[model samples]
Target: MSLYDEVGGAAAIDAAVDGFYGKVLADPLLSPLFASMDMTAMRRKQKMFFAAVFKGEANGADGYMRSAHKRLVDDGLIGDAHFDAVALHLQATLEDLSVPGHLVRQIMTAAAGLRNAVLNR
Candidate 1:
């Protein structure tokens, strides 16, 4: 089964994106970065993006990730710490939702693969 399906598809993606952002926005280290963002739109985009990623439908995702976060990278607002924090939030969200451990590991592995591009490396 696709990771998306394994994780409960759209409804789960929606919950995860919301839950993840809630953690991020509440985090002192991450909140400032998201302060001016349009969270509604951001959440929508994230839902779509994560859905695509989990479904293994992300073509050209690395380039897209690079472009998407280039501004943050240029500003030096994002780095290993920020990436790690986001990953932790995702891991927590999956765990909170009771997704199986093996599936969570698979998803995290996929997310980790995008780290360089996300950092615009």
Candidate 2:
């Protein structure tokens, strides 16, 4: 099964996104970056993005994420430290939701792979 299916698909991704964002927004370093944004839309896009990534449907679409995050990178709002914090939040969210450890690692690895694009490095 695809990683998405293994992790319970859309519902699981949605829950993880919500849980993950809760921690992110509560974080001092990360919260400011999103202060002026539309969280509802951001959440929706995150769900879709995670769904695509886990399902392996993001082939050749690395630029999509990079472009989406270009503004944050240009503004110096995102960096390696911010990425690490986000990854930690994701790990915690998956664990909190009882997702398997191995699956969490896979998800994290996939996310890490996008770090360069996310940071525009």
Candidate 3:
């Protein structure tokens, strides 16, 4: 089965994204940067991200990196620490939901690839 099929598709990704942002916003270290925006849309984007990864494809996430954080990073509002916190939050959120081991590894590996694409500093 496709990893997306394995995890229950878009709905599962939605839950995971919601859980991740909840953890992030609740986190003292991570909440500040996200304070001004509605995280809902971002969570939707995250679900798309996960869905693509789980399906073993890359569909515009590269384009996303180009424009996605242009404003924030250009303003110097985000850096390595913030990225790491987000990664940690994602891991915890997935763990809390008991995502399967293989899927977890797939997500983590995909995240590592994106991390390279993300913070090019």
Q: Could you say which candidate leads in TM-score?
A: 1
What's the residue-level lDDT of 31 in candidate 1? 92
Candidate 1 contains a number of clashing pairs equal to 0
How many clashes does the backbone of model 2 have? 0
Give per-model TM-scores: 0.97, 0.95, 0.85
Which 10-residue window of candidate 3 scores lowest in summed lDDT? 112-121
Off by over 4 Å in 2: none
Candidate 3 RMSD computed on C-alpha atoms after optimal superposition onto the true structure: 1.8
lDDT of 2: 0.90
Ordered by lDDT, highest first, the candidates read: 1, 2, 3
Local lDDT at 52 for model 3? 80
**True-structure lDDT of candidate 3:** 0.78
lDDT of 3 by residue, 14-37 (tens): 888888988988988778878887
Of 1 and 3, the candidate ranking higher by TM-score: 1
Give residue 66's error in model 3 in angstroms: 3.2
A best-first ranking of the candidates according to their TM-score comes to 1, 2, 3
- Model 1: residue 7 alpha-carbon error in angstroms: 0.9
